[model samples]
Target: MELKKNPKANVGRNSSLYFAVGLNVMLLLTYLGLEHKTYETETVKADILMMTEQLEEDIPITTINIPPPPPPPKQLVTEVITVVEDVEEVEETFVESSEVGQDDIIEERVVSVEEVEVVEVEEDVEVPFAVIERVPQFPGCKGNNAELKACFQEKMQEHLQKHFRYPPTAAELDIQGKVFVFFLIDKYGKVAKIQTRGPNELLETEAERIISLLPKMEPGKQRNKPVGVPYSIPINFKLQEQ
Candidate 1:
């Protein structure tokens, strides 16, 4: 069996067109709705400026009477006379010429030995340890120049070891460094001009204290003459590991 329908009666044939038309209309409506904008309007009022005519009052010019300035005062002229007193006369002293003439007689005066003063000046000479003819002798140290030098070093080390004491403050702060001490042995075999350079004042003070305890020794000699000796030594301050 075959079913026949009229050409105008076909609903599916116009359904696609109707759907496209409806879709297009819906899209247009959506676009218009999305594109629509509303702006708020505020009313402004304008005012007109009116120029009003003003009346000007006439001001009268008043005259003021002022008296002229008083006349200048008159000055009187007076004469002055001065008198000077007489000054006393002074005598001029004559100076003799320092040049001596061959014909001039010179008096002979005897100068006694006791009448003339003799001044003796002692010179301060400093000699280096290496170049000194005789180095300062430490107590209980005796030898030749080379041997004396070695003995002195050994004795110095012994002395340092005997008196080495770390500063309590420096140790607490963990301060460690090498202190360079420069001291001068005077001609009288006494230590002087002791200076120290270290990382901290405590270390320097300790080093100075140790150096100050050094026993008096024989003064250094240069050319068989006693002289001040300048010596430098280094003291190491180190912390032992636990």
Candidate 2:
């Protein structure tokens, strides 16, 4: 068959013909690429499903149960005891004789008796006297009660001159105080149980020493009998002003 072409239509158709042909070729290539991608995806999915089914059939599952350990054995304990015996003392018995007389038939009676006595022994203790004659007296003390207090004060002054050593801090700081000491005038009139009532430990110690060195005096008299008496003394400590 012979195709007839118009001159005007051919002139207009030639310019767009090349562009239309290029567009159709691009569309056809895109459709073919999409179909190839779809086919590859479906093939991969089928292979994954088959692998999953084979693995599920090959793997096996198991369940196990374990029991706990047994308890330990019990131990027994034993204790032993010992006993001792005691001995008792025996007592002695005495025999008695009886005599009978004629006429009235008088009988002499004999009596048996046990006697026990206790004896206590006391040891005599001789106490040594203090060496009062050796002690140096204060200038005004004449060994009287009033003089004794002055003698103690003088002894304390002597002690401070010889042995009144104090700590460096206390000495440098000029620490000074008064201590009240209470003591007993014993039956022999010697100082005993001297104790301090205030601070100043060094002063208290020196005061106690002075009191201990005091000589025996006539004991305090109450109703004309020697009786214990309480005595209080104040020891004053002061720093010499330079």
Candidate 3:
């Protein structure tokens, strides 16, 4: 038998076909891998961007402003007022004597004598006569009235001499003033409820001291019995050269 050429064998005999098939498979695998890697990278980048934006939004910033403060109040002042009473002295009058003549002759003679002045001598020294009226005593106390008046005058004089002496500064400045003090003599003749009515501190202090040192007065009597009485004492301060 003679060898004959097979057409089918001839048909499958192209090297280029096999090469094309292998190249197509390799290209498809490479395209799929590349697409997968691109998607993963894009997702990672988007996540990172979102986290950065959120961090920026969560932080906060602030600003502040402050102002200043205000001042104080004032004080009040008061003035002092003093009241003084005037003392008047009484004048004495003398009467002349008339001489009587014989009744039948009906002649009358008037005799005039020179006025004689009686001078007051104190501590062996002569002083001008000054008449001081006796202070009338409270009613119903009888002889005790005279005694109480004398005692009160003496005590007042002594108290003035002792406690009313002012400081040299006060005297030099001529600080002459008066103060009115109010006090109550109890049933037992004790000085109580003493109060001063003026604004001068020094005057008030002196008045208080003098009033405190006063001896217990025999209580003012009503029908010969002890009774409480309220008294107001006016204290006068004057400066004289020593």
**TM-score top scorer:** 1
Model 1 segments more than 4 A misplaced: 1-115
Candidate 2 residue pairs in backbone clash: none
- Cα TM-score per model: 0.54, 0.34, 0.36
Ranking according to lDDT, highest score first = 1, 3, 2
Which is the leading candidate under lDDT?
Answer: 1
**Backbone-clash count (model 2):** 0
Using lDDT as the measure, name the better of candidate 2 and candidate 3: 3
Q: Residue 79 of model 1: what lDDT?
A: 81
Model 3 misplaced regions, further than 4 Å: 1-142, 167-174
How does model 2 score by TM-score?
Answer: 0.34
Q: Compute the lDDT of residue 21 as modeled in candidate 3.
A: 94
In candidate 1, which residue pairs clash?
none
**In candidate 1, what are the lDDT values of residues 33-123, reduced to their tens digit?**
9999999999999999886987899999899999999999988888888887779888999999988999999999999999999999999
Ranking by TM-score: 1, 3, 2
Q: Candidate 2's residue-wise lDDT over 131-207, tens digit each?
A: 23222233445665456656756655674456545545657766678778777765556667778855656666665
Against the correct fold, how does model 1 do in TM-score?
A: 0.54
**Worst ten-residue run, lDDT, model 1?**
77-86
lDDT of 2: 0.60
Model 3: lDDT of residue 83: 78
